[model samples]
Target: MNFILFFIVACALTFSLFREILKRGSDSILLTVWKFFSYYTTLSNFLVLIWFAALAFLPSSEIGQFAQNANVAAAITFYILTVGIANYLIFGWPKLSVYERISDLSVHAVTPVITFVYWLVFSEKEALQYSLIGYWLIFPISYALYTVVHGKWSRFYPYEFTNVQVLGLKKVALNAIALSISLVIGAASFILLGKTVGRL
Candidate 1:
């Protein structure tokens, strides 16, 4: 049942991504692909897509070991953002209707949880290395820079903390700094925990 459900969600996400890519026209595919992957949520979902693909095609293989450390980082970052969103909503609910809430919950909560569980069950402990810890900053930093540059022209920010138009550049930078530090810390902690569990 779980496999069936995950496969369906993965197909949906991949189809959605393909639709987005097709909308880019022949000339802009490269730029459109880059922009789509720039979003943390999309990147996280891409990881989920890969995981689902591996499980479907290579059932005997340890899918989590494919990109063990990077998978760890992505799972950590996804859950961190999930918790951050919950905290943000606590201060004031966003005026989301039932459908929006369900959509958000699936993307923000369900997917991340599945990622973490996949790591716990399928990832090989021997594959994790301390040297890869610094690599965790790649996506977060890239996304931060992209958010700033994209917001400048679009005047739209996905999250409140990174909203330059409203929070101002200085404050947005500060928030990004804080978030980057926290993300690294969270990633490190997860790595340590995964390593310890792998030992057992």
Candidate 2:
């Protein structure tokens, strides 16, 4: 299943990237690629791709072992689930070409669901800790910081909430705080769920 998911995610990511590149029609493919990868959805999907690949082919390797850690797995699950939920709440469903629809569903919906299900069913729950929620938060916080700094330079923010130019620093800071609180709640829920399931 891990291998199969790896293949599916790889295809989805590749299709999305190529479609983005073609849509941009930029002479500088590198710039297009960089902009494409700047989105949280893209980064989350890419993380899952690397994770599934590690689980499928390198179970005994260091990275695979790291991926298998219960806290790490839950963190990945939350991040990907955020991708789907945030997309729906913020963007809703826009009409798209068939290829665009496929890519969107794969990354934003299918991957998050399957990844969470995989973690819930297979991940070792014994190691989950409340303290680790702080650690799990590092990725999103760092991404938020990166987005603000990068957006300032590039005049491009992937999400409207994070767009400081239009929203101003105060609004963007408030948005970040809200998101951080939500993530804390979400991570706590995951830890509790893991403990409950582990007891069974």
Candidate 3:
């Protein structure tokens, strides 16, 4: 199961990354690399890599629980990215090829579902805590700040929600606050679910 999860995530990462490089260029890849790292989806996938590695190599009752926390956090980010992208598509973004759609769905949709199920069935749920949600916000907050500062110089924002130029600083701050609140709620819900199911 760990191998399967690893394979799926590896495929998604490779597909999304190579497509970016191909469509964007070899010499100009730095911008694409920077933009890719700026995304929550990319960060979440990196967490999934850690989770997968721990599952494959770590002792079940030892380090695996620690890795489960990473998975829970990653699942939240993946679902958030999925919803955000769905909204983007609803607003009439051009349709993509089937492979592109599959790659997108693999990261944004499938990864979340699989990770959640993996947590539910295999993870030591007692390890998850509501307080960890506070830590989870740090990445998103730092990324938002970087996006705004970088946009001032590069004139590009990776996501519409963080585009300070078009939305203004106040609007961008509000969006960030709203997303932080959502992350708290989502992380809390997962923690509660883990506690409840662990008793069963």
**Highest-scoring model, lDDT:** 2
Ranking by TM-score: 2, 3, 1
Q: Which ten residues in a row have the lowest lDDT in candidate 2?
A: 19-28
lDDT of 3 by residue, 20-133 (tens): 777775548888887777776776776676668777777375677566564454444445454445545654445888877777777676776677677668666665666666
In candidate 1, residue 46 scores what lDDT?
Answer: 62
Model 1, position 58, has a per-residue lDDT of 61
> Which lDDT value does model 3 have at 198?
80
Deviation in Å, model 2, residue 116 alpha carbon:
1.3
* Per-residue lDDT over 1-200 for candidate 2, one digit per residue giving the tens place of the 0 to 100 score: 99998998898889888888888864489888998889989999999999999999999999999989888888888899889998998789999999899878988998898888888889889789998899989989999999999999999888899999999999999999999999999889878988999889
Can you give the TM-score per candidate against the true fold? 0.68, 0.95, 0.80
For model 2, what is the error of residue 57's alpha carbon versus the real structure, in angstroms, after optimal superposition?
A: 1.7
Off by over 4 Å in 1: 1-8, 11-39, 58-65, 68-96
The model with the greatest TM-score is 2
Give the CA lDDT, 0 to 100, for residue 22 in model 3. 71
